[model samples]
Target: MFNSLQDKLDKALQNIQGRGKISEINVAETVKEIRRALVDADVNFKVAKDLTKRVQDKALGQNVLTSITPGQLMTKIVHDELVDLMGGHQEGINLSAKPSIILIAGLQGSGKTTFSGKLANFLKKKKNKNPLLVACDVYRPAAIDQLKVLGSQIGVPVYTEQENLNPVQIAEHAIEHAKQNQQDVIIIDTAGRLAIDEQMMNEIRNVHQFVKPSETLFVVDSMTGQDAVNTAKSFNDVLDYNGVVLTKLDGDTRGGAALTIRTVVEKPIKFISTGEKMDTLEIFYPERMADRILGMGDVVSLVEKAQEQFDEEEAKKLHKKIAKNEFGFDDFLKQIQQIKKMGNMKDLLGMLPGVGKAIKDVDINDDAFKHIEAIIQSMTPEERRKPSLINISRKQRIAKGAGRKLEDINALMKQFEQMGKMMKMMQGPQGKQLMNMMSKGMPGMGGGFPGMGK
Candidate 1:
């Protein structure tokens, strides 16, 4: 998402990397370039200026007149400033009340309802809360149906009063329903207009007063850039939202809203919705985000995602299979499914140090593996288990069955053979020695790539 900004900043910092000392003139030139990068990324003018000013001051103040690389030192300074720009620390939701009401407020097309469902799923899985998603957007029956579908997907109940036109009454009744059903968390999805108007603003304010929510979140589309910041200011004027939820971050967004919203609205960004999946929502961590912006990756978050889907028993079985040269197509398919569950392919790869910048310009479609999956699925049980048994005739049949070319089948088989060899080698005694060497040669590579740590 910060692809352009990262490139520009990298170039700006490169100018100082070879310097033996940090000079005021050189730092000023680098800071000017950084400021230009921020401005071009759609960051607010005042914010970009103030951020560069702070970074420059810090770099100059911390100057030791030694041989420390000015580029790395200044990178840290800019990273810290970026974190402070986006709310220095993570702010969690307030779910203290027995039936905590989280009022959702945003304009249309801001992904308000989607974030509501994702929030419910997150709370249900991570917070152990019985969340009831209330559909209070009486104007759009589609929104009510959408919420119901999402609730069904997440195994959460949806509270809807189809006959009621008043949102305040609907939310109030939903609170009562939550009490009856023992739902500890209540998320109300209110109506939104194409743009902010007095009628819509007053309606949301009334609903806010009636529900007396523990938290009010203003959802915004990050793709809107500066308009997202302006809209947030307007909503904050009336709703005084407790936090912001930036959605559609997975799109081709410059990510200016994430950098500028908190400074403008004086609200914490509690959550960020990456993709459309219910599992795509994540708590906004400023330092980790700053890490990503500086091309350092977010290895901590990457490990957490892996642990969420890692099965100890399955790993042991896979290890045994690898040791015995019995790792078959079934095992490979299982691994693929687990990786798919980790989130978007590009997003997952982006978590690795240096991978994001390497593949930023590549068109990473979510369905990139579909053809490979189809080819694997078309293989017979015996053929999948015993790849060496497949001859040219079998390849032709499988290619036709998968609707792929004969070359594709041959390529897959070749890749599988190479992978089997690698697995066998990795399980051998020599592989253990090599692993020990690597473990001692470089640290943190086992958990994540090197150079990701501060």
Candidate 2:
């Protein structure tokens, strides 16, 4: 999301990398460029000024660390400032209240309803809470049905009063329903107007008071830039929300709202959502985000995501198969499923240290694995388990069955054979040594393209 901003900041820091020593003039010049970058990224003018000024101060005072170059010192200073700017600590939702109520507020099209569903799924799966989603957005057509569909998908129960259009009554009554139904948490989705209308604000404020929520969250569209910050301020003034949720961050390349919202509203961002998938919501971590912004890569987050999809028992079984050279298309398909669950294909690749900036201009399709999966599925069960039997005739049959070309089938076979060889290598002495070396290898390799050296 911090694409252009990262490029500019990286260039600014690189400007002094050749210097033998740190100087005030060079630091000032770098700071000026950073400020310009922040402004161009849609950050509030005053916030950009203040951020760069603080960075300048920190950079000037870093001269005592003489062992480090100016570029490295400035990078450290900027990283620390970014962490501070984005709420130094990660904050979680408040769930202390019995049948804890979480009221979601935001403008229409801000993804408030969808976020409620994702939050319900997260709490139910991760936090071990029985959550009830309250469909309180009665004014919007199909809003109730939308919540119902989301609940059905996640296996969570949704509360709705189809005839009642009053959100306050619906919210208040939903709490009682949750208590009787043994639902430990209640997430109320309020109606959002196209613009901040007086009636809309008053209705939400009333609902907030009636529900007396344990925590209130203001959902914002991150792509809206400065307008998001301004909307957050208005909502904070009325709702006094406990935290913020920045939605559609994957579509937002500027990401100025994420950088500036916390400072503007003085609220911690509890969650950031990317794409429409319910599993794409993530807890906001300031330091990890800062790492991503500076092209340092978020290895920690990437590892955490991988850990989420890792199955210990399955791993042991897969290891045995690999050692025996019995891994086949079925196993390959299982691995693909786990990887798909991690997130979008492109976003997953971008998590690698050097690859994020390197592939910024590349169009890595999310459905790139679909055709490969189809070809594999077209093969007979025995042929899949024993790819050695798939001769030219079989390949042509499978290609016609899968509605793909002979060349595509040939490519898949070649790749699958190469993967089989790789698995065998991993069980050998040399491959084991290479794996160990990679365990201690250069962690964040900066990826480059043909014309990217500039």
Candidate 3:
């Protein structure tokens, strides 16, 4: 997610580690480094200079109090400046009007269709609005099918007119259909070109005029770096979009678009698409993103993801089983399934503040739990309930049945045991103390283990 930029910024701040006070000479050196880091991240040169100047001025103005060190002060100033650069506050989609219309515009393969599905799912679940996805990409028949598949996966209805080639007419009819069906929101996914063209812009503009959308979102691939910012500006010039959606943030994006899009286009980043899955869409938060870029970890977002997946009834049942010391392979398998439902593992891990950089080089398969799931599914209900009763012969049989080796089964058992022990410890009085210590020692673990503290 911006690991390279984060490393550069961290190194830049480290240059003032031993400084006793914020002097003009030292501040200038640090500011220069900061500006260089932003430029390396693909930020617009002028934006980077303006931001660093503001940070420098803020640092120089601060009184040298014993409450914080120079390095800490500089980090704080830069954090605030980064937040301000990306929009100091969170901006939400406008759903004020009845049958609120949201028009999505972007270049082809920029993830516009996927983002439309994600946004519809987001509004349906988080905003409690009934959303109808309209397939207006008449040029590609596959585009309509893609939206339909996504709509089915998210349990959202998709409206498409296969016979009508005019997108404007399709959108107009979809809105009317929404009104009759009591759909609170209508998201129109229009066609796109490999590059920006007059015909594409005109088509989207015509739809925008006919729908008069409450919000028009410009989706851009962050992996494209500065080009993303420029495309955003062009789209904003044409459609006057209400917000921007930065997709493929989970990729090796240098953080250029995120830092400069708002400055260039004057539109807040409303959402970020971390993965190809529909559940991977997240509302953009400036402060959280700044924290992530600084390698400080985003605990707030981690907790929110946990809360969204937490079911009170399921929690109570699990608690009862744990209290009885009956937590076994079945429960563990169920837990894995629940986590898989949350989203892709790498994407979820990247949302954790420090884990993004740490795992940047590590190969984490999205199907890391495949073998574990297969082993569990091979077991009988009795075996799942009482894993301890399985002898060496049973182990070999289970391994063979799952098409895995005996060592694989043994390794899974070890991990399962460790997890059980940790859960037990978390349920103890000293758990909070231990958790606090671990949070400070290994921030990455804090992200993976949610709902254990607080």
By TM-score, the best candidate is 2
Compared to the true structure, candidate 1 yields what TM-score? 0.91
Give me the candidate number with maximum lDDT: 1
- Model 2 clash pairs are 354-447
Descending-TM-score candidate ranking: 2, 1, 3
True lDDT of residue 212, candidate 1: 85
Off by over 4 Å in 3: 18-23, 63-68, 350-357, 403-405, 428-454
lDDT of 3 by residue, 44-156 (tens): 99999999988877887885333367788889989999999999999987889997989999999999999999999999899999999999999989999999999999999
Give me the displacement of residue 344 in model 1, in angstroms. Answer: 2.2
Model 1 clash tally?
A: 0
List candidate 1 stretches off by more than 4 Å: 18-22, 424-454
Candidate 2's residue-wise lDDT over 89-200, tens digit each?
Answer: 8998999989799999999999999999999999997899999999999888688889999999999999999889888888878888888989999999999988897898
The true-versus-predicted C-alpha distance at residue 341 of model 2, in Å, is: 2.0
Worst 10 residues of 3 by lDDT: 445-454
Q: Kindly list the per-residue Cα lDDT of model 1 for residues 1-454, writing each as its tens digit.
A: 6888889988898888867666788889999999999998899999999999998888888882353666778888999999999999999899999989999999988999999999999999989999999999999899999999999999999999999999988888888899999999999999999998999998998999888899999999999999999999999999888999999987888888899998988999999898788999999999999999888889899999988899999999989988877888888888888888998887788887788877777677879778889998999999888887899999999999999999999988888888888778988898888788885766555444332322
